[model samples]
Target: MNIIISNASSDPIYTQIMNQIRQSILSGELQAGDSLPSIRQLAKDLQVSVITTKRAYEELEKEQLIDSVVGKGCFVSGANKDFIREQRMKRLEEKLLEVIQDSKELSMSQQDVIEHLTILFEEDQTS
Candidate 1:
């Protein structure tokens, strides 16, 4: 559970925590059955309010990313990796749709945008 909170971001603290944990789980960094720190301990470690950590944990549970077992603390949920990957890709497509719309509004042709994306993709692949 390596989380670095960005206090300067517009996102709320709890949302920052939830998003990072979810990403970690989806990326296989936090595997199923991995134990998460207790809420109190995490709060102290992150130097955030207990309520903030609690809310983040609660949201993660709701998203089925983590499960709380009585007397055992919280553990990463047994979510299928394929499903998580699909879900993440779908979310990314939605965001890309918004960016595509903005690109059109800025008078950039689709081909231009795609060419730029291709360059970026190639760079990423090389790296």
Candidate 2:
């Protein structure tokens, strides 16, 4: 597993850590039962505090994305496909809402936004 931290981000260090790990699990880059680095090791690797890593792991555990075993460190949890799909859809919806707000602030019409989205969709398909 690889994690990158940015001092320029608005998010806290722990939140950045959590978001990266969450994305990895949701994208299947981290599979069920895959081991994660120990908290101390990850802290050393990231040059962050162990408390920050622990907080990220704890939050993931609350979301049932990972599980901790005594003396065994942490591992990704098996997920229901439906639940995972719902999670991804919700994230997309949140991003779409942000785009909609931005478009409205710029006085862009609905049709204009739709056209832009269509072009982006086609561009993605072609790529």
Candidate 3:
């Protein structure tokens, strides 16, 4: 598992960790049954407080993205199809929101935004 912490981000350290891990799991980069580093070890590696990593792990568990075993460490859980679809849609909405904001900032018309999106979608399909 790979995680990068950004000191400059507005989000809390733990939230950053949790979001990356969650994204990895949802994207299939971290498969079901893959063991996660111990909280202490992850804290050390990330050079962050142990409490931060623990909190991230707890939230992940609550979201059902990871399961904690008594002696064994946390492992990625099998994702439900519906849950995965929901995650994908949420990510799409976030990206679309950003695109809309950028378009507005650029003073682009609605038709311009739609044309750009259509081109991008077709390009993605061809690739």
Candidate 4:
């Protein structure tokens, strides 16, 4: 449970916490059944309000990324392969949307964007 909060970020503090935790789970850095710190402990460690940490945990639980156990603590939930694939696809769509917006701002044609993406993909494959 490593979390960094940035007051300067446009995202809310709770959102930042939630996103980082979600990313850790999605990336397999936090394995299934891994114990997470108690909400109070995490709040103390991050120096954020307990309410903020609670909200983040609630959201994660709602998303089925973690489960809360009475008197124990929050723990990472087992991953569902289908759900994970869907989440990854959603993330990819978000990133592509950002790229599309950037390309529009730069007056780049669709073909130009596709060419750049293709080149990047080739470079990545080669690397």
TM-score of 4: 0.70
Candidate closest to the true structure, highest TM-score = 1
In model 3, the runs with Cα more than 4 Å from the true position are 87-127
TM-score of each: 0.73, 0.69, 0.67, 0.70
Off by over 4 Å in 4: 88-127
Over 44-69, each residue of candidate 4 has an lDDT whose tens digit, in order, gives 99999999999999999988899999
| Full candidate order by lDDT, most accurate first | 4, 2, 3, 1
Global Cα RMSD, each model: 3.4, 4.0, 5.3, 4.8
Q: 29-79, model 1: which lDDT tens digit per residue?
A: 988999999999999999999999999999989777899998889999997
Candidate 3 lowest-lDDT run of ten: 79-88
State each model's CA lDDT, in order. Answer: 0.91, 0.92, 0.91, 0.93
Candidate 2 global TM-score = 0.69
Predicted candidate 3 versus true structure: per-residue lDDT over 1-127, tens digit per residue: 7899988889999999999998888778998999999999999999999999999999998878899998999999876847866876897999989989999999999999999989999998997
Clashing residue pairs in all predictions, respectively, total 0, 0, 0, 0
Q: List the residue pairs that clash in candidate 1.
A: none
Candidate order, TM-score descending: 1, 4, 2, 3
Candidate 2 residue 2 C-alpha distance from true site, Å: 1.3
